[model samples]
Target: MKTLYVQVDINSYNGKLYDFKTDIADLQKGDVVVVDTINGMLIGKVVGYTDDTKATKWVIDKVDTTAHKARLERDKQLAALRKKLEARRKAVDELTAFRHLASMDSEAAALLTQYEALIQ
Candidate 1:
């Protein structure tokens, strides 16, 4: 199977980015990506290609079988953690709505803080 590395630059605050070899004819622009945010392994679509030096830069860290496995595992864990976080956020929203109905501003504000913490 053809694999691509999900890449990002520290300067860009965008969610995630990807880089792949252009030699693969099947890969096209605007493909959706499933990326390993840390291990540099993931699935992502081809957003576009650049002739810029960044695209051709040699990868300092070589990807190995073990690293690939670790990246997959880490992606799975992050997915689970995100689900839990969303649930907590929903709870916070519900509590805030209830507090609003009861005219409890202080409680609503506190719940908002809790919600932010859960997201972070």
Candidate 2:
């Protein structure tokens, strides 16, 4: 199958930003891309693809299936970690509410805050 691979740089807070290469064929929308992020590789579903001819020059690399699978596994692990973090946040919220309703125990509040901060 003839596939198009485009290079993209994703910032921590900002999202996927394309660094278009002049030599490569302009990528189309719905193209699958393997983005190399800070933590690891990620398979990003293309939301936007452009044919702007004035982009900067760069090299495009071919992505194999093995690399793609590894990216998928990494994504799964990241998702699980996010879920755990969210659960911890919810627990902290519950504890804070409980503290407000019942006791004004400073120790329990401090402990929950410490735990919540640690997860992040």
Candidate 3:
């Protein structure tokens, strides 16, 4: 019998490739599977099959549809939060630049400083 070695790529890990042994014959590309790594159990996508015979880890199980949906939602939320923060940072920089244009002792400069501190 030929041992199946599946190449897995974890989303968070990006381009890294991890190989694990499995008996599940129905697994296909893009299928999410739980892998047994030295650190612990991790979820990864099956990118392809590997021909290497030496294997020390096993693919525990495929991730269910419910879990996959939850992960996708979590990723979406994280991306939205990152975009919001980026916009806020750009606004803050513009505000700071606008404030710096005023004279050092002017009342407008003082007010702007107070407003900037409040926003920050």
Candidate 4:
């Protein structure tokens, strides 16, 4: 019977360190591995090796990290978009105040002064 072995030390989110032995000959140090957890399968980085901790479960797989990369990229784009939207909102409000001021509305200047103060 073949049993699972984990040899690499992993960085887990919960700050737990584990030692496992694997039959995967090419499973080297510094690889990203998928391991089974109580919550779900999580990705961990193989930072080093150790003989200290015991492993009772298997490293499910070694993933390519395409999904992770894509998620990071999407988040970056989303942040940029949100920042642009906020800037545009401010600009639109300022333009509306200018229009009111052009019509000689009395409170428009006060509104613009308040906006400038808030921004500073």
lDDT of 4: 0.69
Residues 4-100, candidate 1: write the lDDT tens digits: 3324332233555544343343434554433334545444445555544445422233223577779999999999999999999998888677667
Q: List the residue pairs that clash in candidate 2.
A: none
Tens-digit lDDT track of model 3 for 15-44: 798889998888899998999988899999
Residue pairs with backbone overlap in model 1: 31-45, 32-45, 33-43, 33-44, 33-45, 34-43, 34-44
- The order of the candidates by lDDT, greatest first, is 3, 4, 2, 1
**TM-scores of the models, in the given order?**
0.34, 0.33, 0.52, 0.53
Query: On residues 48-79, what C-alpha lDDT tens digit does candidate 4 reach at each position?
Result: 55554467666777767788999999999999
Candidate lDDT scores, in order, read 0.53, 0.57, 0.86, 0.69
Q: What are the per-model C-alpha RMSD values against the true structure? A: 15.2, 13.7, 9.5, 6.3
Clashes of 3: 0
Count clashing pairs, candidate 2. 0
Off by over 4 Å in 2: 1-63, 103-120
Which stretches in model 1 have alpha-carbon errors above 4 Å? Answer: 1-63, 104-120
- Note the clash tally of each candidate: 7, 0, 0, 5
What ranges in model 4 sit over 4 Å off?
1-6, 10-17, 25-28, 35-43, 49-58, 106-120
lDDT, candidate 2, at 74: 100
Native-referenced Cα lDDT, model 3: 0.86
RMSD (Cα, Å) of model 4: 6.3
What's the distance in Å from true for residue 38, model 3?
Answer: 0.3
